[model samples]
Each structure stands twice: as C-alpha cells, then as structure tokens.
Target: MGEKLIYMDHAATTYVKPQVVEAMLPFFTEKFGNASSIYTIGRESKKAIEESREKVSDAIGAQAREIFFTGSGTEADNWAIKGVAYANKSKGNHIITTNIEHHAVLHTCQYLENDGFEVTYLPVDENGLVTPQQVADAIKPNTILITIMFANNEIGTIQPIAEIGAIAKEKGIYFHTDAVQAIGNIAINVKDMNIDLMSMSAHKFYGPKGVGALYVRKGVKLVSFIHGGAQERGRRASTENIPAIVGFGKAIELATANLDEYNKKIMALRDRTIDEITKKIPFVKLNGHREKRLPGNVNLSFQFIEGESLLLMLDMKGIAASSGSACTSGSLDPSHVLLAIGLPHEIAHGSLRLTFGDENTDEDVNKLLEVLPVIVERLREMSPLYENVKRGNKNV
Candidate 1:
C-alpha cells in the first residue's frame, strides 16, 4: 500500500464531495446556460438557481427569497457589512463587532471607519469567548449594526450568536454573522437567532470553491454592493455561477442529512487526539473553550517552537495541518485571534490547528498523536528559545 497522507486542514477547505461533483457535472456541460437570458436553456439555469437558493435557505432554516449567491464568502461578508453600513449610515454611524472576527468582517469595518463610521471591537475572554453582557454594554444609541462571527476560523470557538442576535434585536440594531466556518458544522436558524444578515461559503463544506451566499432577512434593506445586472433581485449583480451553485445545494443537502452522525464520529476522534497530544507533549496548550467549540477543531500551541517550522516537519511526515487562517498564512504576523485571547506573542507564534473532516479516522488521529510529540520534541531541541529557557535565562 502507498503511504497515507493525513489531511487535517478542513478549516482551511474541504475536498468537494463526489455526490456534489455528480450533481454539478451536467450543469457544466449539457445544461450550460446563462441564468440571465430568457431563452429555454437560460430558464433551466434560472430554475436551478432558484432550487439551489431554496436548498441553501432550507439548510439554514431561512426563506427561499432570502438567499443570494456570491462569488465567495469574503464577498458575501463584504457585501453584508458594507451594504448594511452604507444603507444604514443615516440611522447611525456606530457598529459593534468582536476583536477576534475574520479579516473579511474586520477589514470591511476598518474601511468604514475611514468613511467616518464609529466601530466598537469587543474583546474576548482568555477562552476566546465574547459574552452577551459585553455586547450589551457596547450598545449605544448611535450603534446601527452588530456583525460577529458564528464561530472562529482559527480557534474554533463557537460564539453566543443567538444571544448577541437577541441583544441586537432588542436594541433594534441589525445583526449579521459571518457563518463561513459554522455553516455545515452546526445548526443555524436565522429567525431563532434573530439574524438580519449572514454569510456562507460552499468550500467550507464538501462543496466547490468560489461560491457562497448572503442571507438577507425579508424586509431588511441592504444597499447594493455589486451593480450591473438585475440578478439577485438587483442587490448583488453578476451572472450566477450555475454549476457551483448546484454543487453547493447538493453539498448542503448531504451535510444537513448527515450532520448529527458526522459530528458524533468526528468529535470522538477530535477529543481523543486532543487528550493524547496534551498528555504526551509537555508545555502544549489548547486554544478556545474546551466544550464550546466546533466538534472537529483541535487547536494547540506548542511552547518553544515556530508554527511554520512545525508545519514543514509535519508536511515531511505526509500530514497536513495549518498554523493559522489560510487567508493570512503568507503574512509574518502571529494570529490576531490567538493574541486577542491573551496568548503571548511568542506562545501565539507556535499555534497549530488540526481541524478534522468527515474522512478523518481514528487511525489518522493516532498517526498524528504518534508523530506530533516527536516533532515537537525535536523542534524544541533545535529551538534557540528552548535553549534560553533551559539555561535559566528568563530575560529572553
């Protein structure tokens, strides 16, 4: 048998499911048509779009008309934040979000600040949790919108989204959540959560990349972020991506159908991996709340090691993992999420995220549990920081 390549980077992206590919194949060839044209082929494409919209909406317990396809989760996030910010600018210039939000929401908020909007970035606890009380405290008369993520991308800390949403509703402020990481892993209901706007990406689930959606609650007004055609009810404009939309719809169906079973199985492996890694590796710390995180997430920080060096070593062993958010991997900075949760810069620099997927088995977990301790030990021996610590040099 060939050597196994354990892929543990599901948080970064998941492989497209075979079912999803089968669902999308016909659309790419025989059914190829612009969703905009009024001809027969075009009508078929339009029908597929609407069907996909319903599937996605149903998965999230949202209405069919509320779903609008976008090019990516980032686009959905940008449109949700900037669209709401600009539309409600007359209502108030203040917005509230957490300090640990994904860059899509964070950068958009920063851009709005340049346009004279006031934003309050709430801090998280050491467990990477933002309390409802903290959000309630941040509310002001001028606060118009509150956008927080459903779950953290790097640490996998599931936020109190419904609680925050309730606070936003009671204050009459629009609530939006970047659910890119949370969509397929947990249940989401826009109505129960009191969410006015939300974002999702297909790639996070077992679907194709470069396709995502924004959920706008009916009666919530959003300014158009993209303008050209009448597609997406004139709110978002572009020719709809038909094949990817079909794959997204099918993927959501599969993910929803098997969510409970998948979570139960994956969480077992995840917990076992966490326990073994922490017990075997001294000076290793797990990030995020122990119980209040995604089932597949296992984030850890190894002392006296650089995360990139660790990733390279793991790659040589044919295991795939991540140091931080793939979006910011090329950057030199330590994860903002880790630093926000009280990890010292040096400690944060050694963080690793081994997010599991449906395909990850106990054997894979065992392989990691076996290899990781050895890698960390080897790395620490070569680490100058470890040497300093060993020599009783506290100043370093």
Candidate 2:
C-alpha cells in the first residue's frame, strides 16, 4: 500500500532495540538519581551503573572493574590513544596504526603527532588487510602503543586482531582496538584476543547513542583524559548517564546471546545481495576480502558512475545505503579505506557500502537486488566515462 523502506547501513548505526529501551525507561524517571549522591536512590543508581558495567565486561570477557563509560566511541578511542600515549610517554613516543582506521582513531593519532609523538601508519594489502608481520617490522623500541581497529567501518575487513595483540603482548606494548564496528557483530574475548585496551559504542549494537565504554586491562597505565570529578574511578569524570548505560548493557546481552545464529542469518542475506548484484552488474568490484569480512557487510565499487548519484537513485527507490562511513560521508573525497585497498580514484568514488542487521530480511535483499542493477545501469548511461569506454577509449 505504501512505498517500501529498506535500511542497510547498520555499520553506521542501528536503531535502539525495544528490549534495550524497555530496560532504560525506568532509569529515566523513577530511578533518576545522581550516582555520586549519598542518598538511597543514589545508591540504587550506583548499583545499576555497576551492574551495567559487569554486563559490558562479561560481554567482552573482561572484568567488571575494567569497563569505563564514555560519551561515545570517538571519546573512548580518543581516551585510549591519548591516555596511553601520555602515560607511557616516558617510555616511548612512537605509536603504530593502520592507514585505513576510522578518523576517531586516525585523527587522535594525528593529534598526538602534533604533540611530538611519532605514529607509524602501516599500509594494508589490496583487500585492506595488514599483516601481523608488518606490525612486527614497523615496531621500534620507542613504539609505546599499537592502535589498530578490530574491523574497518568502510570496507568491513576484519583484521587479525588477536595476532597483532599477541605481537604487542610479546613486545610489551599496549594494544588498543577501536572495536566500534566489530563489537556485537563478531564473537570477541578481549582476553583471548590479548587486547589491553578496546573501545565500543552502544548505538552500533542497537543501544542508545551518547554512551560507550573503553575496556582498560588491569595494570594498564592510562593518564586521566578528563579531569574533574571522582567518577569512573578517577579516570573519566562527569555524572554517569544511567539510562544509556542500562540500555548498552541490555543491548549487548541480547546481541551476544545468540551470536552464531545472528551472524548466520545476516551473512546469508549479505551473500545473496552480493551474488545477485555482482551477477547483474558489469565492471563491479567487491571491496573487501570475500570470506574474511564482517557477516553483514557488502561493499562494492561500480565503474563509470559516481557514488552520490547511485545513492540518490537508491534513495528514490526507498533503499537506504551508504557511500562510506556516515561520519565522513559529508566529505566529497573518496574513502581512504577504498584507496588503501588499491581502488583507483574513480572506482573509489563509486563505492557503496551495505551493512545488514538482525532486522534485515530476504525481502530487503530482494528489493536491493531488484533495484540496484537498474540504478547502476541508469547512472552509468549518463556517465561520459562509460560512454568513452563504450567507444573504445583506452585511456579511461
């Protein structure tokens, strides 16, 4: 009866789940109390906060004391990088990261560089993968921290985090991963992964926005990033956001409850979408590793057409997708992740990213497969580059 709406940008963010919202609603009104207050309601607030902390910790196989809430994944990332960098500055000034990290990690590393820190941005292969050996080779005695993302936001490539973590562990360097894109999508044990510090955003996993957590391993030296109150064990300060924290805990609990099943379902839909699209469209390239990527991610680059044009046409068809990370979508430049994976500027500009979620279904994939080929064809017909190719112009 109405226009169909299909959303496939779960990598950017997910809508809050009903169960998470239900868990949070009471905290906003009747449970409203400052966690720092000394009253009974305040004590209740503190209890809820700690319970949420334990939930977050358990989700990632961490200890209750290790979880510290932050304003967002970006803040968690900033604190992890700068906090570790400053605390261990006496030891070394060099940090190692990948060239394809989210700006949250990349920008923080850049900021530290301005503060006299040296960062080694390791390059990835054409599939956007960096080897643990490369990390080992890049290490200098002054390398104090190794901050690589668990998975890429744009390309959906899951790095060998455990191997890198092991390398960092052997080298006695603090390892941090911006797991904003990997959390809740894949099974993660911070301990098994040998991660010293990790970052997460609740909104990426069907929890509310404005709440995230950083997992700091015991004995990790991290200088206080926020200096004010005594909150977050004197590390991060500010009044605790109880509602959002509750939601985060509940969201992760639900997400991890049946991780394998969720991945199986989403991966099926993702594969179908990829297969159908590639079969129908010519001159299309898959952006990430075919088997080693996130289950729900499908990134493709279509030749001879601009990503913006394709997105506009998909929007008209009631299909919501993305050209790159939503945080960097406003930029006209091609995605750095695409370029790092060896896509030429033209193909990189034409890249599309579709990330599925629990709510996505076969119908959604069907709609996408039905409409995307037609859209690509329509846009390419309007492209002068495509016309030149048709005319046998070899330069393009």
Candidate 1, residues 1-396, lDDT tens digits: the string is 255799999999999999999999989898998988889999999999999999999999999999999999999999998888888888999999999999999999999999999999999999999999999999998998999999999999999999999999998999999999999999889999999999999999999999999999998868999899999988888888899999999999888887899899989988998898888987889999999999899999998989999999898888999998999999889999999999999999999999999999888988887888889999999988788777885534
- Candidate 2 residues 1-396, lDDT tens each? 256778999998999999999999999999999999999999999999999999999999999999999999999999999999999999999999999999999999999999999999999999899999999999999999999999999889999999999999999999999999999999999999999999999999999999999999999999998899999999999999999999999999999999999999999998998898888888899999998899999999999989998998898889889999999899999999999989989889999999999889998888888889889988889988898887895546
Q: Provide the global lDDT of candidate 1 against the true structure.
A: 0.93
User: Among these predicted structures, which one has the highest TM-score?
Assistant: 2
Model 2 residue 328 lDDT score: 88
TM-score of 1: 0.97
Error of 1 at 237 (Å): 0.9
TM value for model 2: 0.98
Give the CA lDDT, 0 to 100, for residue 332 in model 2. Answer: 98
Candidate 2's error at 363, in angstroms?
0.9
lDDT of 1 at 349: 95
